[model samples]
Target: MREILTLQIGGYANFVGSHFWNFQDEILGLREAGFEDPMIPTHGLNMDVLYRQGETRERQATYTPRLLSIDLRGSSGAVNPSGSLYERPPPAVVSSIHTWQGPAATFKAERHERNKFLQSLDDEEAQYREQPGDAKAEEIVDVEVNERQRYIYQSLEEEVQFSTDYLKAHLHPSSTYQIPGCWQGVTPFEDYGTGQGLFSSSARSEEIRDRVRLFVEECDTIQGFQCFVDDSGGFSAVAADLLEDVGEEYGRTPIFLFTVRPPRKVYDTLASKKKKITHALHDSVSLARLSSIAHLTVPLGLSQVAACSVAEHLAILDEKDYHTSALYAAAINCITLPFRMEAVGPSDGSQSSGLGGTDMGTALPLVSCSDSRRVAMMQASFPSPALLESKGEIFYNLHNTSSLTPSTERPKLGDRVAKLLVLQGTQLPGTTGERATVGQVHKSVVKAHEITAKTGRFSSRLATSSHLAISECPLAVPLPFPFIFGNKIGRFGNILSRTVGGGKQGRGGLDVSSVPVGASVSSSEAVLPYIKRRALDLQRFALSRSTTGPSLLQDWGFDGEESKDLRERLTNMVAAYSEMVESSSSDTD
Candidate 1:
């Protein structure tokens, strides 16, 4: 098995990562529930790719994600930092202290209480421990225990204020790290320079490196690392340093970075304007630095998700990180599905020439365009309707969810772009909703590509180099998944011609279980505009002395020299895309 190490930096990134892991936990649960079918085959996916098997001190088996998650102190909420596999000792009493007895005054802080969902999980575990090993008894206990938990999970919109509130997976003790002296609301970790030199401390750096080495040494064959970094703040700097260390130690391993941000809010105050400018500068600098370290960088999140075409059928709350993160997590889950798929036979119509499913090592290069384009955009269509439901339409409409925007002007003739498409659990529309075969899925994608090119949804003159992958397994909606889908979505994720009246309503009055997803990672000129915009933002702030840009950057610890270097890097990135387009134009001539 080729194992992949996952890393998540910052609170928002962890919010997205929590949802992503919940999806995986749901898949594992479904497989255990004997929910496999021809339409949704779980056996074809190898869970070992992202998970590790181990035994607890009590000789009981435990399966946990091979992940390293970092966040500010007190960000973990009710979840224990040591994890659930081991028992936690109770808080020590002040009376038990023997030292410092003179003039001692004790003040206890209130601890975060677990929500109903977590409490239910504890109750279920206790019930299981008390019961005998009879299969029927265990089944009965599970059903009874899950009843309340399911209700709470589905109704968690108001309760899930933090990532840990809805988290379903049990992380290993060593997988979580909280930065000392950094509290979410109290500390100012809002810029790239705030996180600089955080890992420079020898003790902290060595501890993180040792933990990473422990996970790496256990894997038989390590494929690469998949990282999620919060680019809106200091986490970006933290991730850059971490990735740099990983690169130095394991130079051959590939790194795929997803720089994520939450929905941006608008304000018109004078102070707010200055803050916005600071944020823009931070974003540009973070992107330039982080993208240079990772093999492939995909920027995610939108200023307003509800304004996007992808959310047309869905009801989204722009202010809620729970809703926005779920949307991004679904796309990430679908795109990364191929990384863990079991290799079987040759690649039918898939892009890669290799046999079966593609790995990160092979898949990264396909979209990166041979390293000439390291930055790419991602688009997704969630709850993609079945063929029959859409009047025999084979392909679902895709919308760009990444920050990159397509140019208003038509692309020049002979402009070539590359995209890696992953379609999951596409059904043939009808009451039966039978899963489409590999050939059917591939044909539909090709037809969609041709139609898209003609319609100029991407660009009329642009020639797209498309690589397709199809999976029979759809994304399972875990209990804790946010109810962002509309009432028009059916229980199994099919699109109803009309919205359902009412039944057992969850959040947003929808009850969706599994969803077919269409997601793609593309390397094209579409990213040119985004790169250029950031580059201009950096240059405008760095060179203009009239504005507070230089002073603000200096406050964040970026000297004049570092600011100049960042601008140069952004310039080079923009030039890379510009050169690719010119080279393609010349080849056509």
Candidate 2:
């Protein structure tokens, strides 16, 4: 019964945020064939996001309370968000109602005495001056004054509420997809750049306040909090602020952060150098600052796929790497499984058997709460066929074994320390349930807890003649996927493949692979060096540019020197990535 609030900030984040919710919704069986008692994820809240971009029209048109509750009872025939009455049934229909409380005899005696006293007023001049009926009277009337004040206050409150609701209704968080009993932050359409206006907007602030007052405080057995921050400045800022406030008051309530690194879009030829450099710098500074706020932060990058068993082995011509998000989105569902589906439950004959997993309330401390503040990133691995199609299927079977080796097993091989979220295998995907063996759990736990090695130590440099390096494995990720709305697909292949064993990569981007048949497996080879290098270049450009670059950094509470420091640290990794891409490219002479 432990509760954790899920906060989604920024446009892309909302997409991923929705996937996270969808996963929970599927797991708990809160949809069509409802579970006996479906529950929110043990990892965090269902989700509250400031969504922009691709929002459903229904969500776009509504202004729901940032905080809300759902009635699975179907009592709420329509979408009525009426105050507290939403929970309890309206006062039962009654036979008769009496309004008067006083007896007729007592009322008449008091009235008679009052009339006599008023008639016998000894000081006519004093009484006349005090009389409110007199136009010239100067006396103050407390009752009238209170009444007017109350009217004005009520009107103002109503007006303010209306305006806020109007704006909130348009936000992605306020949309129809939101879960019952879940609270959301106000998603305002008015985005003032990335940092403040989006995260600390008036609406955003009010929503946070409401979330704390309503959800956080109300939960009697609340555990920790988990936040998903997009690369946007405001989203992370607000998330940090809210977590800090709650942490100060709640004392030691662990807050885990899942932040999406700004994808590298500069590789596109049409992209201007100025824009590329600007984005890179902006992202680096934002990530660096965000890293410090969360107790433990997991940063995700699109470049992660460069280290995969298949993709890295082959060459990808599409520089856009648009599928990176899709891949990450799928990875997110798998990696977070340890926390979300703590214990597997029994299937009640649901079509997918997705509800076989149970909550790991007792194991909360194992995954959700991280004491180490250092190492704010982890490497991400996604199996073949992108996420939108695979649903939650775990690809790259041979990558992990029945003996789940820790992502950090080879600690001494590299100098740059890193962690990997190697969520391998296909089990409990949305609508598709692959029985999870206790042996698998044992392997996953054994490796998940093990602290691994650093980045490449002796790996050859990319372009530079330098010897320093980082293994793609060591690059830090949030330990969660980069799921988004449309990007997080649940392609379970054909119903035939789903029913049988692993086979082919389907047109729907579904994986046909059933159980691991051979020695081959799926694995994530982190191309972190490329990711860090890209960020470094962006940061360097930001620092090298005019005062505007530095000012932008300052505006977001990041200083110039720190940005420079980060770039410096990423020097080796960047070089290694450059070499890998160069050597890996088929066109290379």
Candidate 3:
């Protein structure tokens, strides 16, 4: 069984990656038929832990990855690039403060005070009153010796030894924490950059390259790779490029990218225009390059998933949308359902899925492919029904295995059929045989897609229906599996009475096309809105003399020509889908 290697670049990506691993099929172990012998035993690569503190010198070499270069035990891979990087500590300058600093100084001071007290006691020779200030010095010293010597020894309470932990606390405590996880149980761990990120400058540096070489060599059994690039376009783009190079050198490995961006609206409303422009340029440039390298790249951003405009309480939510990483993590667990599931078959038995005919040496090739037509597919995913304020048929429409959502003007599903995998969460309420069973979820799936001439937007919203072949990818893909915790219950407020579509008075299923997992539009179709917006923005920026005509793209290592090429291909690709739909209808007529 070919295993897919996963890599997380930058901060948010690492956060998502951590949760993804913590919530998968192998949280216990992998047990598929052909996948019996896992391909990527080492699992994956993580870049955020690069310059970790003492990880190298202190900790035992047990796990390949631990978190944050903040690690009390992360490797010291930082290089002294310039002045005073480590010129030397300037010979321990002993100054005024050093004399009275610390326990030793306190001890010396105490001893000195004690000695002065003793001297005072001794100096109290017979302080001869009156004029006797002249009693010979030898006689005074003789009297003092005789007086104090007569008073003998002193005693006090017995001393008690303190606890070992206390001694350790004051002395030295263990600095390294035993973090969980390993690359297939243990080997050479890599550090990719400074604590902030692997900046563009460091992407191709010798240190990072060496680490990549080592990572690939060890992943001899890997068949495919999944990468996470969250918001850090410069560094992540470079890293993604390096992986692409590696894939080309050894095998034409299919690389899937999950590029997460925060809500653009959030930025537009909250950030400076220059910052927004900077983000836009970085995002567009990175998307262009990363798209070229990966077989498929999915965009994840807050606003992309349109919350319903229905009653105030009717919005689609996944438990909590507080953290982007958590939401993306939940989505990852949902999207990767096919690999984790028992081989497709009758619900009665535990037979192995016999589709050994591997594509590109990988098992589930359709989910991720090297097809140029399939690249840049729009992605959407609904973690569970709990995300909805109201449950029932409308709740069913918000989930998709392909993560496809409707485009602004229409749903993005293309002429190709879609494959849906419905992963059930434990929160799914049902009695004994009724709760979240395959049959239950299957019914929910069918109910969500049921078409009635009089039903909610099913008639007019079918914009490109005739030419587009909805079932040919073959048909919509859905998978219903055992319950998962990521789909929590009671997180979204108690059920409310509401309409499926937007208006408060309306009562019907959601304009299913508009919900989060609303529809199965082709990724190409789904990306049009964002792409068109980007193209227009870039054109102005790339054309303006003050902006240096495409220098931003150049700075980020994205070629101006390549940007135009990809954008053009996508524009044409979406158009072709429309043309195909139109032609099919004409032939039928």
lDDT of 1 by residue, 45-74 (tens): 888999998888898899999999999888
Please list the residue runs of candidate 3 whose C-alpha ends up more than 4 Å from where it truly belongs after superposition. Answer: 24-26, 29-206, 213-220, 264-266, 269-277, 304-322, 342-372, 375-383, 386-420, 426-434, 443-488, 491-524, 557-589
List runs of model 2 lying over 4 Å from the truth. Answer: 30-194, 197-204, 232-251, 261-273, 303-326, 342-436, 440-548, 554-589
**lDDT tens per residue, model 2, 435-459:** 3333442333333223121233323
Better of 1 and 2 by TM-score: 1
Whole-structure CA lDDT of model 2: 0.35
Comparing 2 and 3 by lDDT, which wins?
A: 3
Worst window of 10 by summed lDDT in candidate 1: 400-409
How big is the positional error of residue 352 in model 1, measured in Å on the Cα after superposition?
A: 16
Better of 1 and 3 by TM-score: 1
User: Which scores higher on TM-score, 2 or 3?
Assistant: 3
Alpha carbon lDDT of residue 168, candidate 1?
A: 82
Q: By the lDDT metric, which is better: model 1 or model 3?
A: 1
- What residue runs in model 1 are displaced by over 4 Å at the alpha carbon? 35-39, 87-109, 132-150, 265-273, 347-356, 370-372, 388-415, 430-432, 449-465, 503-510, 580-589
The model with the greater lDDT, 1 or 2, is 1
Instruction: For each candidate in the order shown, give its overall lDDT on alpha carbons.
Output: 0.77, 0.35, 0.36
